[model samples]
Target: MTFPAPIDPPARLLMGPGPISAYPSVLRAMSAPLVGQYDPFMTATMNETQSLYRDVFATANDATVLIDGTSRAGIEAAITSLVRPGEKVLVPVFGRFGHLLAEIAERALADVHTIEVEWGQVFTPSAIEEAITRVKPTLLALVQGDTSTTMCQPLEEIGEICRRHGVLFYTDATASLGGNDFEADAWGLDAATAGLQKCLGGPSGSAPLTLSDRAVEVVRSRSRIEAGIREEGDASADDFVRSNYFDLGMVLDYWGPRRLNHHTEATSMLYGARECARVLLLEGRNAVIERHRRIGDAMLAGVRGLGLDVFGDVAHKMTNVVAVEIPDGVAGDAARQAMLTDFGIEIGTSFGPLHGRVWRIGTMGYNARPDAVFSTLAALEHVLRRFGARVPVGGGVDAAAEALT
Candidate 1:
């Protein structure tokens, strides 16, 4: 395949699972010249980044930070560091990402137990309480939102249950953090991980994480000092963790005043993550969440106006994204292809049992705008009609306008 010299593509809307529209400021931050990994100025910026992300995460924990990889890295770091081998971890499976938590726990040699829920629904506080009581797990790992089926799991009530049972509650907020209302400390979440690509309006290369004092204790108990960093007079520490790279003890030491070397911190990605949190904090967390809520509601109304059935529990739907059923007589693949090729729009298809039955539409981060919502609906209306799906002319746009207003 031959590629032409760079030419800018037309501004097409992104309404997919992730890597949604990034803010111009974040892009510009990435383009700035790089500095040495251990530069004093870089460390100062890193400290500031942590401070900004603390506000974004709504936590006062000093351990709040950005990991060098994508959202999954944050999850792995949190899991591998917090869950020691032979410890029981209770996971309630509702979507694909819950399966991810189970798999990661299994890799960690954890005694994993699962409470399965039906697709398109979430677990109740009582259900999780029963699981925790039965398993007596040391850790509870769950996802705040699973994009595979467009389901947002209720976390506040579940967190309280974990707290009561003396279980360390951990969550992957990759798809929901900045898009919804999350109170890390108030809700009793021991640790939470997120990606920059979702509602933060940044690239996917950075993962932000926060941990409470309970989580810090877990890490401190398992911490291990690096061999290279040892000195003649220094004695070995038993609290050292197994994995050198993912060790939060090492990371915290490096991030703290010690200024030791860990990974050659992704300098530009740090800038991007910093700006992402700064932008969200500047907008105010509640206001940012409200913006996503308004736009998501508009998108839902637009889909309904197009005569399509919205999937999942509408009452518990996430503020950042939505799921809609593929109407009868129209090929889901054909409609999606038309939306991509003709309208330059990108949406998502579901997985597992919902495969070929639902279309996932997202209104997240920089794309959460009234104009973006209307444009996507208008394009989808035309595409649906073109595929023999019955849709009233301008109905989707009209409904979305009313909802946005």
Candidate 2:
């Protein structure tokens, strides 16, 4: 059988829920020469990356580090290490990703309890607090932004609530960080994890994570020395983390001064993650978030101008992603295909309850620009019209441009 010729892929604009176009600098950084895992330069680069992500996470926690896998790896690492078997964990489900948190916790053998709100809505702080009080959970795990519904759960008050209730709090900020407001220390979050593929402007290989002192203590208590490096006096716990690769205690040690052997770090991914954080910090976190807000507003206005209704509560929607209802006459998949084939643009489809009902469009990372937003709007309008939807000519682009002004 013949294999494909030398690699070549079509150039296209990614305007989907995630895995958006990475910043050019991030791509370049990943192409740099590889270095030995414990090389002085490599360790220094890792430390610098940690420092940069602390600013990105808006925290001063010394436990901040990168997990050498996708964002889900960080999520599992935090849950598996911090939540021992039989521990109660409360997850407030608003959309698909909230369910994901519960699933991960369940796999960790946690006594996971979940409270549900509709997919397009978020849990109120009071509602989540009530659940916490009733369940008396050891940890409250939630997602800050669930791209499935384009809704961002309000975390500021929830964090405070968890503190009052003596429940450790963790949030997956993969889709929200960099383009939204997240204060790990200020909000009292015990642990938080993020990915580079969304608003951070990089590919989806590295997970940036941060843990407060309290969360670190929980992990340290369960720390077990790796077998190869185990000494007589080394610490080990009876109930060690289930997954070796997803153990935060060992991961932290590897990233810390001990530099104990764990997995061989993904060096290229480290470079990309470092560059992603560096670019965001250089641009100023607040400024980058505001840019997302403006671009999101423009996109929202453009879709509305095309006579499309938005899903979920507009006030609570994520700044990076917007879910627009598919018009009655338009075939969602066909329209998406037309946009991709004819205009070289890609938008997202929905999941679960929202499937075939809304198109999840993203203005995130390097693609969160006025030109990108405008082009997407224009292309979408054309597709909708061709599919027999009554979209106003030029209205989408016009509204977007006006919103920017």
Candidate 3:
């Protein structure tokens, strides 16, 4: 039979929101030899990975582990496991991901409540507190970074609000964890989930999650109470989490000292995920955040130097992504395609309300460097000129260079 050629895709500088160019070391880790699920080496690697992520999340929680799917999988695992059917889950909507949280919770059969701030804006702690007081939800599901709007919601104060209201605080930190400041323990977070594709500098197959003692207690209570009911044919409890694969109780046990079996470990992805964390920690977590801040700032300055207006409130923008308004008469998708097909660059476009109106450019992960930022701006300047936008000769690149220095 005729065979397809070796899969070779074009080299792209993925300057979009995620799945950015992973670190060279992380790529190498994925190609390492595989091992048995129960191998001592594998278990030790798992323990080491958990330790690395504790440093990454800035928490000492013993329940840190990886969810074996995309960042969305991590989000689902957290929501489905924490919220029981018909229990209230409060979601404050500010962007596309917020709606996703509500949708996930609803599918889990939680009574989902959502209050909206306008797109491009974030909810204040007082706003969240008021809602928590009124709705009295069992859990507060929030997105720390919403790339669709390029907003990084301030989580430090919201954590306190959840604590005061006796609500479990959970955040989807997939896009913001390594790039911004996330103090899981200090922020009073009960649970949090992150993906390796963003600032962690890896592919999207693995998600790092951490659960505090308070969250772990809740998970254990449900699982322990319903442990033997299945065998006794007494389905009366109905409290076991709806999913075995996503059940944190089983997942924790698998990662814990018991070495119980759960999902067949995706060994290669784990390797990549571990390396991602390792590189971040080696460089120092705060240093990585500062790097992202510097690069993202340069990108922002570059766009404005090109005479582009930024989308949303600049004060609340993420440290890794900036949304710039598409110039009048410039076709958004055509410009994006030109950047891809003509320059092999991939800058993202907004979703929903902001779609076609703005371009979301990201400086994150391995691509968050001055050279990458400069190259992208130079190419973007050419693309803008092609679309008949009046772009200055070297305005973008010059501005970005100035910022970096």
TM-score, one value per model: 0.94, 0.97, 0.98
Which 10 consecutive residues of model 3 have the lowest summed lDDT? 224-233
lDDT of 2 by residue, 146-247 (tens): 999999999888878988889999999999999988899999999999999999999998999999999988988776664443443443543677677887
Error of 2 at 9 (Å): 1.5
Least well predicted 10-residue stretch by lDDT in candidate 2? 226-235
Clashes of 3: 0
Better of 2 and 3 by TM-score: 3
Cα shift from native, residue 253, model 2 (Å): 0.9
lDDT of 3 by residue, 147-249 (tens): 9999999998988888888999999999999999999999999999999999988999999999999999988876743365444355455577877778888
What tens-digit string does per-residue lDDT give for candidate 1 at 327-346? Answer: 99989988998998998899
Best by lDDT: 3
